[model samples]
Target chain A: MNAALPILALFTLLALALGLYARRGHDMGLEGWAVGGRGFGPILVFLLLAGEIYTTFTFLGASGFSYGSGAPAYYIIAYGALAYVLGYFLLPAVWRVGQANKLVSQPDFFVHQYDSPALGVLVAIVDILALIPYLVLQLTGLGIIVSLASYGAIDKAVAIWIGAVIVTLYIVASGVRGSAWTAVVKDIMILAIVVFLGLYLPYHLYGGIGAMFAKINTAKPGFLVFPASGQSIWWFATTVLLTSLGFFMWPHSLGACFTARSANVFRKNAIALPIYQLILLFVYFVGFAAVLSVPGLKGAATNLALFKIVIAQFPPWFVGLVGAVGILTALVPGSLIAMTAATLTARNLYGLARPDAKDDEIVNVAKAFVPVIMLIAVYFTLSGSSTIVSLLLVGYSFVTQLFPALVASFFPQIGVTKQGAFAGIAAGVLMSAWLTFTGQSVGKLMPFLPQAIKDFNVGIIALALNVIIMVAVSAVTARKALQPARS
Target chain B: MRPVYWIALIPFVGILAGPVLHNHVHPFILGMPFPLGWVSVWLVITAVLMAVLYALDPANAGE
Candidate 1:
């Protein structure tokens, strides 16, 4: 057996135990499985939403950004805090609409709110197209975590298979409640391990946190501060604004909002969630500590900066505990996306298929798709790799297009024409794709455009165009459509 | 549009002004770069503002 085998097995078993524990003595029905009976109060709702937000991206991506890209990493911190402010108003309305309409999944909201099954279908297609790749990304993160944590004792492919199997079974068995219960365990583990490493790694290596950052700032000059040159402040500000708008727009997040017993749960969570930002700061400390010591991490290799730092500084057993957190970060989100995707598949796509399905039938069909979604994600994890596929991980940009439609739903008087919303979404997706795949953000396309526009994230640029098209088209349509009907 | 709604803009503005205010490497505040320190301060402030908003909102008073 490998040196990591014992602790790895122990943590993995603990994960499975927690999954089963959440299901004990509860009657599992469609609503119970899908949104945890729409009865959860503040604490469970908070944990569920937190689990969904802090995925492999938070664990690996933030530290990677700090190590590789310099100061732009602060965007992660800025966006989440801003999002809570927005969600304070946005989610209560979303929850109110969801509760009134009896919406269980993402597409159900659009269908009931707009009274347009076609719009629901379009949103469903866009959402799932965006979501599958996100699921695949988390699976990939799990594979990397397992492979690296075991010191190459476990193969990446095998590790991903094990992760997929566990996540699939647990989600299928326990549903959103499983994900919530597991999150409670995952958050505790994450808090302990991160704070320990954050304080110890810096102080143990350097004299203290202050000394470490001071030395880096002195050596690299602008390294500790935001880049004053090519990575302009406009880029950072727009990126944060874009991410904040798109933050809770994800299908899983919207569905989770429906789980809250009252809008007060969301309101309370918005107040409390920012406290978790302090934990993210601890991870940032670890990332900043890695810079001078673990230098020369090129490209995707940068994601390993924090983990490699932990390995170099800590013992194997403690490293094993961190590895467990890595797997939890990946698996918790993987299970979430899988469950949400399955919810969409049964609730949305199954409607397109049968046209006459029953509620129980839809629920059963969704439960069945749990394994299929996991299989598809795992297949992409082990076998799929292409530029287009990787670009799909930029789901936030595309999904930000949904903001106009959603805001319209929250207030009926907003008056966005369905055709306009459709056109806007189509335009946003295409613009985002063209800008991203063409490397426009890197100064490859549209040379005549200003550097500032080019420097802004493609998502924000696409969102601007989406809003313009939506508003202009709606104004023209509403003037013509409203006059004849008002009489 | 209650006055409470404007409170949300405090964190939003503080972060958007990141490029303008405290855009420097020197003089770390609590062991962080000025921009980062600026962000960290506003993050906590955002929550406090949210708490105050919660208190002021007529919706919560009914409970």
Candidate 2:
């Protein structure tokens, strides 16, 4: 009677075996554990990057957005396609810098560029803080996926523990290489499940997508597109801009940049990634179909729209398999997030703190952080309030604050001083967090400003201020340097 | 003297141009909603644009 135990356990074992096999015969060192020895070709790089970016957020959340809200879901497609374009231009240069510096982690780039080990430590701390929430999101979603698919045959806490233990063990044993290989499996299964559901659900329920939309649009006019005055056109535009900018700034993505054998690998993936995102369009279709067939989903229940439709429409075994795929979606990205957080602590923080720490020692130290990171995430998962989740969610934009400093690092003539970077980052994070918190607390930050710009994400507004501070500080420092000094 | 990087900005702007194009839901294309089609069109164009930008790069020219 129970579908979750057999299906999830089998695939989890298979995935664990595959993950373990991925790192076999590879030497463990800073390079291996952090960047997969920087030897992956274009194809592996594509799968790893794609798998990393398309997590449970893409699988469950996007469709739910479509089911619950309608047209704003298109931002998922808009931001992703846009992000790869940004990535295409920005990442190759990053790869070049990383290669030149022999950088294994994101903070390594920060250290080498800003010429400040202290900055590296700051980056490591900020990166881990930013990542734990994302990891917690994945682990929490995995728990729900396992229990839901099993039809409550397994307890949600049990599912969460199972996912946490497996993810921790495999990531520690295999590192980034293990993460990439498991990604290959996750990607194949996800694409299959998503595509099948996207095509079959619409036709089976509503005869076709055209007919399905005809009913939804008839019932609820303007549900298909964003409103102009309230959200305004700029609202959508700003979110796409802010989130896309935030995309590459993520430490896992930055670390993924160094895994490539060449910078060209990033360029090729940038082009290919959009085509991969077209899959989301199908996911949108699933969400819209859930609206018509499985109506009345509310709040947290909305996220269950896609999976509920699958369980209702498909056989129990297929439902179990879909559940397995969902778990993989969570685990694949969770492993990468955990791996990067560990890598940042080991390579950037520990290595900087103890500069004499050996290569193998750094690698070992990072491996040790693997379980610690997961356990901390699991602890937060168990204990964290909605307020805590909101706190971390606000931090998503704090990572984007690093964009100005990061861009300056690539160009020495930009004159971004170390103090300026520090001041700018602190201001950016503080302002961005303040804006997000106040908005959540008070409902809106500015009622006086024009509806168009005022409706936009606070992160971009904070980012604009961040850029000004960095430039102003840099100009002052630059001018001060040029001025003659008296003894 | 010109920056090819500036040219890449065109595609980025194009990607965000959808919601600002219109406020209503009546207009549809390719048997889908307007925003959906707008994003799909840009998604394809983004791929082509990145490919072109790659070709234009002197660093990648040796290939």
Candidate 3:
């Protein structure tokens, strides 16, 4: 009878209702739609940020990585905790600047800070480029979740189409508030489901958590800890460092920060969100439990670790519940990413072209972009474009290029000029793209380097190039500014 | 930045140093792998550290 399909459908409808309900008492202007009028308090801000940070990636990607690679997955947990440590200081400053300047999009910060609309345009392009793959990844996960949970009764493409339409509907109606409302349901459901599955699976299968690890250690030696080479300690450490910096650089996360009313809300969130991040630990538990109980899930199939075990052990009704929660995981973050990309397009990209465009016109344009972006994501999802899927791997590194310019903006002493910022970012993005497309790792790029250095995440190399280029160009341009004024 | 704010470095140090400090699989803390338990412990430490920072910092004092 496929009870999971009905459960999934009902939850999707409920999320849409909550999203629409969120718009009842609020204005839906450009300011209201983009940043929720900059009036979200501590709890809403926390859940909204959590909603963006913990996406379908956390549910499938985190668990799947643990099932496949073992200890390297611990970097996922480490990076989030450290990123919030950064958010403790970083987000409050962003919120303060955002409030003062009426900033709505992430690129607006760069535009104002550097006093360069051109830089804003560049940022907007990079953001949307980075976001497309991210959005497609979420939709792809949604299809996989729905089809797998439904016992193969539903088609993946139909599930993706339905998910995309629902996200667009809510986001156009309520914008960031829609994502926030859905997040409230999502956070509660995920916490309950993940904790239950994480505990029940290990104890039910292997007598206890400790026993599971002991058996896994005996079965797959050295899988429980970092190896001396390949994805070693160095890789874990550097990857954690790269991802933490890149976390807030995501346009959606930065945009989420602007939704808060007070700077202190971020400060308070920083204290609690790391605790929230501990949820990933249980996710890892679920992945580890699957390694022994439900084996042979290789490559991409590894992502089904959570669902496969659940369906094998539990009834259809419980599987439906898990599927319902999985749908929220995709929809909440998908709505936020779509909204961020649309606002970036309408305001920074289109608004720059038509400077005379009114605020009402810009908001309408943003709303118009919501479905367009969703359709593009849907097309890419169904087409199975290898180009974009490969781009998804470098999405983090591509956006991390902005970190040097972003942090430099906060400190005027560095004197990073607009030209320098532009050149550094362009070069960094190009470097990462070339490396990714060519399938070049640090080891492959420079065979003479030590294995430890070779094992470092290639993103660090891109970021280093970004910083070096930024500093050199800034130095040259800064001196040029100080010297005689000759055109 | 104030001197007290330096306390935030403790989590970064504790967690990133896992490769060198707690890379072994044995001696699982709370029934998890050594590295997994290591990160779990640091997550708690980070939360506690932030709470302390929130209390001691003057910027958050009024709010």
lDDT of 3 by residue, A348-438 (tens): 9999999999888999999999999999999988987332223345678788889988888888776888778888998899898888778
Clash pairs detected, candidate 1:
none
Docking quality (DockQ) for each candidate: 0.74, 0.69, 0.82
Using DockQ, give the best candidate's number: 3
TM-score of chain A of each: 0.94, 0.94, 0.97
Residue A453 in candidate 1, Cα distance off native in Å: 3.9
Candidate 2: CAPRI quality band: medium
Fnat (0 to 1) per candidate: 0.75, 0.75, 0.89
- At residue A410, what lDDT does model 2 achieve? 65
- Which runs in model 1 stand beyond 4 Å of their true positions? A384-393, A442-450, A479-487
Worst 10 residues of 3 chain A by lDDT: A478-487
Query: Compared with the real two-chain complex, what DockQ does model 3 have?
Result: 0.82
Ranking by lDDT: 3, 2, 1
Minimum summed lDDT over a 10-residue window in model 1 chain A is located at A478-487
Candidate 1 global lDDT: 0.79
- Sort the predicted structures by DockQ, highest score first: 3, 1, 2
Ranking by TM-score: 3, 1, 2
